[model samples]
Target: MAQNQFSLFKQKFFSSFFITQALGALNDNIFKSALLIFIAFRAGDELGLNSDLLNNIAAGLFIIPFFLFSATAGQIAEKYEKSALIRKIKVLEIVIMALAVLGFFLNNIWFLLGILFLMGFQSSLFGPIKYSILPQHLSDKELLGGNGLVEMGTFLSIIIGTVIGGVLIGFDELGVRILSVLLLVVSACGYLASRRIPETPSAQPYLKINWNPITETWRTFQYARANRVVFLSILGISWFWFYGAVFLTQIPNFTKVSLNGNENVATMILATFSVGIGVGSALCEFLSGRKVELGLVPFGAIGMTWFALDIYFANPTSSYIGELGPSAFLSQDGAVRTLLNCAFVGIFGGFYIVPLYALVQERCDKSHLSRVIAGNNILNAFFMVIAAALAAVCLGNGMTIPQFFMLTAILNAVVAIYIFSLIPEFLMRFLIWILINTIYRVKKTGLENVPEEGACVVVCNHVSYVDALIIGGTVRRPIRFVMYHKIFKVPVLSFIFRTAKAIPIAGHKEDPELLNEAMYSIAEALDQGEVVCIFPEGKLTSDGDMNEFKSGIERIIEKTPVPVVPMALQGLWHSLFSRKKVNKFIDRLKRLRTKVTLVVAEPISPDEANREHLYTVVKELRDDKP
Candidate 1:
């Protein structure tokens, strides 16, 4: 009768984070769009600045803070309490909003440019704290939904801000003044929302501050490097930003040139992209069935390329000779069609980015989470800058907009191939998964009977080390298996298993550090839409008898909305790894009676998955005969 973990988010985390983050995004875009428009209209002649130069400078200014300060910020996040940091950042936003008002009043382009840099600095400082604190406030299961909400909220705010900025500036002097004041008020509201974000204790209180950006950045990379899959996933995330920046920067010109519409038309194009991203972001929770589904990354990337190329091909041949308003373009058949194509591309983008971002957050080392995220932000900035420059060069070299669009699509295919090739783990997991599907038949009923995908502790009777493998192999989706760190290093199996992205858990009483790693991974995996699968029995069954279900599963389910999928292995006790108490030599016999059936029971709600109930269910399933 208990509500799912996802419902907890609607009641608790959603409004606080969504409103705060969205307002922050809205404020950013409103100011940015207004400034860009102002520069285009009023300052161009006075400063002798061209559109491209101004834009490049804006991009440079925005990224400079990330390069200069993300490392220092990462350290600060590790050293201080997070809610206090959030409040402080929000206060800074108030001060920055005042500066925005002054800049607008003075009509000074340089002053406004400086404010852009400050906003970027503020965001960079907030980055590490924003991600690291997630593990503290939300349970493992709410991570993905929380992240998806954040993504959707951020994009939704962006579209709204852009539309408001464009529409407001069209009014006379008083309207522009009103808009600036509104931004300040909204920023203050963001601060108010921050007050609601619960406190998060520092991960590393005594960690030394490293002022050197290069060293700090390298250290962030090093921590991530220790985990190969984590490192590659970081790269994948950065690449997504690069792909996004390229498409985003092109829209203004694409609208003006391709659609031959004025500024209003340009705003509509931007709106489409924003809507697509927002829709895609929200869809992650559902498509993934509330688990961090990485398979969607490939699916999203494929959509990005498909629609991006389609946009190029959808280009209308007819051209207008003179300047026309947006209404003219809307009347043209191809214009609306092209815009929809671009929007669909954005929707796929959501699918591509949300899960991967969640994956990185869930899988990385917890202690150094802030720094790793900081490192990721730095790389994301670098890639975005590179993408912009590359796009500029390609355009300057006489590539038509459609040609450029086509090239990006082609490049996506190449980049996808390269990354997946480098980390064949993604492909390997899919391959093994495919093999499991083709080579063997799997059937289940009560799976839907499992509490509809929220955070709940799964309790399974352990028969073999392959218990996790068989469950993983048979499940319709990926699950983060919690195992002893040592078992994670087993021969061919270890290599294959690690690539499938299993979490290694060491008991806190046995190894504090490994235990810390396990908790962080579990929290992160749940956040990202991955099923955190653990053998509550803790170790493989030495005999056919079930071990006592541990309390760890209970602790995890209590925190998140993930449901408990109870499972039992039948017949695996007779296999090679099963116990033969009479003699050790007798147990060493090669595989015999290899047939195994894994019975999965209906999901138990967090409220229902108590130790006694779970043990009873698993016992019944394990004892069931073929």
Candidate 2:
């Protein structure tokens, strides 16, 4: 399915793993909801515990293992084959579920709580395996689609599990028996499916198991932060979990006390949120054109804050003793709009999470991938705990849910802007992506001519200031541009160039040291197996005619004997960045949505990549459509 992202789900490994993980998620939600509902509604007063408070306690117990055992789990995943470990975890799940059967039979709250802790432990172990295994089985392009499917499966399973568990626990003593039997069967099914997952070799098979969670946790955290982007992405992902936990937890009481709805109405609201998540996950791959697009992250953050604000304003002040059925709720002013807003929040959340997870998988060091993921899980658990506490603190201080929603929405905007400011690359790429896609209808020919791997010198006709932007955006491979020093410093475009690491060159007559440094940077980039791009024409065309090619290409190829691919840009001079009409910025803005075409020619061997030879090739290609 490397050729087709959606077909990835039809493959054997992805399908089996999808089912196995989905079942695990389903079993978790089913057991958790059933137990929580049982405690809230049916647990006898003999225990002498507050139902609502115990509910929160149960939630905390389930996440505590993540904080304590994630390091050990990471080591285990690193030290052993993932599929075998998954099978063993599943078998443990069966045993735990069997124990849960007896605990439910006796209606023993302590025993059930213990089972909940074990379930959390099981999930903690599974978390590292869940993400790290994707890079091994799927291609980079397939990572986004695979993650989308996994997210869809998880949320769809949550909806089913929540509904089924709610209904089953609604029964009398017979419900306990039925719930126990059902959990046992689901655990067994998960084990069976785990058996079918293809073997993925351990990333660190020779690693020693570190049993000390505290010390090992510190080491894992260090490795995770070693990469700046990965660490920042972890923070963004954690914030999403924090946002989600607070929003979802308030739904039940908000539905009952605020919307005046019973359990049925609450279920409908949850189902709507889940449906929206599933839709967003399913559509992400197509929307991204099967790439791990970072642009969607900001797009998602924008929608999330907006929808959250809408939810607050939708029903700013409303409370009732009785209930509004689904029909009556829809009849109320802004009721459907509120539900839709909540649903869209989940939808954008899918966009926010899928790419970040895929980016980590694609970018993180393979040896420490599991540990990084474990650290991420730990941090996510920590942030979620903080979110719960924050919500409690606010409500305890007399903050209404509507007011809290407004506050959280405002906070979300602040957090997003701060994070984006720290890593302007996300915002820069987003702007370039939006500019290219919206301002120009870009067409490409012979994209296959560009090498898919290894270092190559991409020599292209530089007709406009945004040439690198267009080429980099459309090319499958990441390229480092060798660009003009002045253009590379054009305020907003400077951030774009610097973030892309575009080498800034000048003639020796102007700045000899800067030119020399740029040459070395180009060689270093090539040596590191990156595509190094140069505008051999040296400057943007003055009359839509090719200039004499520079010796810069020949000089660089002499130091790094790599393949040279020649490309041409046509239909660009009339736009804003060109000299067609004095190259005014406002002029380009006026011509937004103009058409441009990029053409790539076959690569030339290093020995044949002379200034004259390359110049002829580029000249011929540029003159093709002019």
Q: Each prediction's Cα lDDT score?
A: 0.76, 0.87
Lowest summed lDDT across 10 adjacent residues in model 1 is found at 436-445
lDDT of 2 at 379: 91
Number of the top TM-score candidate: 2
Name the regions of candidate 2 deviating beyond 4 angstroms. Answer: 44-48, 443-449, 543-545, 570-576, 582-590, 616-626
Error of 2 at 44 (Å): 5.1
Query: Per-residue error at 625 for model 2, in Å?
Result: 3.1
How do the residues 229-249 of candidate 1 rate in per-residue lDDT, one tens digit apiece?
788888888988888888778
Worst 10 residues of 2 by lDDT: 314-323
Can you write out model 2's per-residue Cα lDDT over 19-114, one digit (the tens) per residue?
A: 999999999999988898888876646577789878887998999999999999988888899999999999999998898888888888889999
Clashing pairs in 2: 439-593, 576-588
**Model 2 Cα shift for residue 548 (angstroms):** 3.9
For this target, which candidate reaches the highest lDDT against the unseen true structure? Answer: 2
RMSD after CA superposition, every candidate: 10.9, 2.6
